[model samples]
Target: MSSSTSTSTSTSTDDETSSPARRRSPLRALFGRGSLDIQSTLLVMLLAVSFLAAIVIGSVGYVNGRDSLRAAAFDQVTSIRESRARDVERTLAGVQQAVVLDSRNDSALQASLDFNAGFAALDEQSIDPARQQAVTAYYEDTFVPRLDEATGSSTDPSLLEPTSPAQAYLQSLYTVPFDDDFDASLAFDAADDGSAWSQARSDHHDYFREMVDQLGYEDVLLLDLDGDVVYSAFSGVDLGTNVEDGPYSRTPLADVWATALESNTVDSSFTTDFEPYAPSLGVPTAWIASPVGSGADVSGVLAVQVPTETIDSVMTGDEGWADQGLGRTGEAYLAGPDETMRSTSRELIEHPDTFAADVVDHGTPTDVAQRQVATGSSVLLQPVATTAVEAALQGRTATTVNTDYLGHEVLAAYAPIDVEGLNWVVVAKVDTAEAFAPVDVFTRNLLLSTAAIIVVVSLLSLLLAQVFVRPVRRLQHAVNRVSGGEIGVEVPVKGHDEFSELGGAFNDMSRSLKVKQDLIDEQRRENDRLLRTLMPEAMAKRYKEGEETIAEDHTDVAVVYADVAGFDDFSRGMRSGERLALLDGLWRSFDEAAERLGVEKVRSSQQGYLASCGLTVPRIDNARRVVDFTLELEGILERFNATNSSRVALRAGIDTGQVTSGLVGRTSMVYDMWGDAVTLAHRVQDVSSQAGIYATERVVQKIGDGVPAVDSGTVTTQSGEQRVFRLERPAA
Candidate 1:
């Protein structure tokens, strides 16, 4: 009994010794521990001084330095812009002065004016009968057809009053194959480029080239008031082009001429901002134009070119931007009315090897940069779309921290350049990183000085490590899967903390990216399908390749035209959605049949559906294919009638022959076919309300062996009688 009592008493004493009172409290465990604790406390004090003190000092320094740096950058670029603007003004003003002197003293412009006066005085009665007949024939054959093609429709000759100024002016603007103006311009240009046959023209050409070289110009051009480039120091390539009619009219140089001609005085001159001159292989070019004569005696324009290098130099300052006050990442550049950069960047010129990488980071077309870099070309084609540029272009001077064209965050200062006949913005910018380099340095120093506090941090980190490590590891694995394009993964969410929230975010992001990827794929497929439907795949490719005129010849294409016979009256009784739905269903059925039959359905509308065979890719049995498809179309109509209580009727015409096909409109493209085959088909469809189906003679000849048709005789119309056959059901 004594031994048992003694054991119990000993156990109670041991329990009291190991109680909560025996252990150190949380606070004393940290602040009251021995040697390691003293070192930790001292480190914590140093960290407070380093980090907290640094924050107090750096914030004030950052704010002040940022404002000053932005202001200085803005001031520097604005000054450069002003200097460049003055240089452009002076250069263009010189061209004007020279042209005025030529108008008052030279014979070339006077002779040109006399020629124009003589030409304008002649009317239909004053000209020779043969010549007048030739003009009328030319107008009827060439001008009328071109006008119809341009407007995408034909008009009655009676509706056009030839005597009207607008009509006469438009006619005069036409470039007759070898007109006198084109011929003269070609001759002068050939002489200048040393290709002239005539000795006198050759001497004149040499003089022009030498004069251009002597004046530090790229080219010297003389243009008649009618907008024909008469003489060129370069070559005959652009000499024959009339500014009012040819493709060159789309360029900014043409706009400069229009501006110059707005007034009839020698003092009237204009300059254009930097743009791609198409005739010169789309290089950045600027032009200045002035009239050849003063007052009513004005005849033509004398234009001079200033190399973009000269402008670049002014923007960057003398001696390669060293005096421009921009640090490693700061640059001053010019943006024209088109929002395209006009001046070469400083860093690009200096670091040609890294051009591609730098521009890629800025979100530029890296291929263009790589190509330019390979050839040691300047980076003058980048656009600047920041708020500073926007405000500056709109005639407001502003400074802000924003994103620049290269997609870099920058402190930007921008202002509009004060120059006549131009809308240009000047932007000065420095990278946010470089601009805050001092603050970054201060932050690094503070972190380095507080390094002794690592012992305490390590201890705390060890305690939390088990709590964070698992979720973070799972998140890292999930991220790797997502990066590898396996976006269906989900990180397991744990207890609610920042790490758990991070896992939730990761899952949400995975879902979002998957949805986005799906949408992008769908959009790409839709775009490709839409483009192919709007035009032939070949033509669509050409259009995407930047071809302005997309037309092709198909010698044996079969064309079809089909329309709802009584759609207008039928639709009058139906709601808009119902009417549209009917058309949609009808076209969808037609599309299905087309796919089944291998016929190309190019267009469809409320009015009709137009399709072709052998239009893009050649098919030897296209005629037969089209015939079979139309036969199936009739069966489809019968089936549709069986399904719907209200009856819908259709009329169709088919023909096979040579046709010319092309696209129209810049915004919404339309593919159209034209020729006797297409015309006859459309005409047959239009007149056949009760006939149901008509096939022209061409179709019967090319419909191969199995297709069925009956002789339908001739149908008369605007294009004269077209012999056709009626498409009839075969005897089963």
Candidate 2:
């Protein structure tokens, strides 16, 4: 009994394991036919499509957003740049006006004019050698004294009061030229290494030193038109250090002098470099040159130099001005046209050679330079420069780009500085990564959020697919039922959102579909009615099916034309309602007759009707039909003429021709016949003598020879074409 029980228990265990109702083996489920879950596959596809759609939309949104941001930034930058440039231009204009006013107040100019007037006032006899010498001395020395006495120090204040040491020195020099002994002494010293001139030069140097101190400049240099440094603010510097001596001195000073000379001629301003002086002084300096003379000629250049730190202080004074906006940082530099570093920030000044080398290495395109100067506005999205000089020369007020400047990517801005007489370009630069750091952060966060949203949507789609499978299956069955003509199948709607609205719309659509089906049946019957009126039912059906119907050719077809006389006057007198009614009545009558005669009505115009016979129903007696039509029309008109107060009449012209007739015009097809016979028929109606039937010669011959007619003389049309016609009556 124990052995049998153990064997039964083992069999029971095996039966339980192998039972068909037990959970199916995962391996068999995976490998079995028809085992793939369609619902799960559809869910995966939906998730994939949604993810791809999200990515596409996000990518487009990101690009468009970035472009819009960049464009707005560029516009803002451009406006600010233009505003700054206008301010600079206005300031420069004020300085120019001041200079011009000052030039007119020049004492030397007034004195020379007075001297000329005084000399012109004197006779030629009074201009002898002794007299001339006396006059010259008196005019040079005493004339100024007399003027001072007469004006009482108020006539010309800048000259009368020596406000500056330079003015004082100039005053003293004016008296020396008038003093005979001092002039002789200067000539004697000129022969002896210019000792007398040296004293004057020393005085001038002292004056420059005092002026430099007063003006708050670190150094000042006075340059002649020949590029000679005649005076230096620093003491013990040689008076005659010709700028043309050494290569460094020659090239840089020559460039500065040339720029200064050019500025003077135009009463403009420019920046220049100290060159050899930069290395010697252990600090670089820039010179700002302005002209000092009044009429026609410029005397010399007054150049002042300040430490670069001064400019730095000015640029950084307002933090708000420099900040620009988010993700931007900057540094400023002042440079001359020769690409020489003038004044710059501490960083650039400390590494002079490096910055200078960078500036000198690059060149600016001519078109960009012209635009920068001419428009005086900022350019954004311009190509970044590898060098400081190139950045300045390119003329953009701001630039944001990744570039290898001194072997590093940098963002830069170069603003033009229009100091009174200075042509300086200010460049600001920063590390590219530092400037664009905020953008990178924003972009990264945006991408991360987008990725998270996509993942959530994909997971949500799987859950939603399982939840909606049964409801969607029911909706699919209902849709199939509706499509298969099982109407009024109620679909259960559970939601209150768009899905509920969709259910309501589906119910309405079902009702509308039934109504539309009934209407279509009624329309088919109505279309058959319209077809019988238009043509034979069979032909109309063929036309409705888009089959082209070739009209059969008929020889000797009868064409009739009738037109209203004095219709323009009648139309003008009649009300629009009356006119329309009249036209409707006339066309209806014409159309009825045409249908009864089995004739094809070609076209009807505003004041006329045209019909053709023997086209659809070809008959050898087309002329006889035409004559019958004319007599019938005459009888209709005669009855109207007896009863009408308007006395309107219809004139009919008939012609028979072998012509090709077909519908013309794609959108509004109208039957028309084209041939010389058609033209002659129209001419016969136009040139007819009275309101009666006029027939062309060909039409007359076609009607039987027994037909009675009166010969109308040949009439010449407007184009000088002769057409013979006759008034015809049907055989009596």
Best by lDDT: 1
**Using TM-score as the measure, which candidate wins?**
1
TM-score of 1: 0.40
Number of backbone-clashing residue pairs for each candidate, in the order shown: 3, 1
Whole-model Cα lDDT of every candidate shown, in order: 0.63, 0.51
Off by over 4 Å in 1: 1-211, 366-381, 436-732
> In lDDT terms, how accurate is model 2?
0.51
- By summed lDDT, the worst window of 10 consecutive residues in model 2 runs over 1-10
Local accuracy of candidate 1 as per-residue lDDT tens digits, 1-732:
000000000001232234343333432443344764434455555555555655665566556665565565556645654555565556556655654564444554653453334323322223344443444454467544644543335744333223322223222322233332433443343212122222323435555555565665666666677776655555323543457765567776688777777766676567777765644445567887777765667687777666776666566664355455567777778787766677776666788777668777877777666655653434246656678878888888766789876677887777776667777777777777776565566556545544444545555544445444556657666765665557578988877899889889888988997888687667656766777766678876776566767888889888888876655665677899998997789889999998788898777776677888988778998888887788777877778778765466667888888889887655555677778787777876654446467888778887644557676677885667778777876768
lDDT of 1 at 243: 71
lDDT of 2 by residue, 348-401 (tens): 333433443442343434443333233221121112334645655556455555
Supply candidate 1's per-residue lDDT for 181. 43
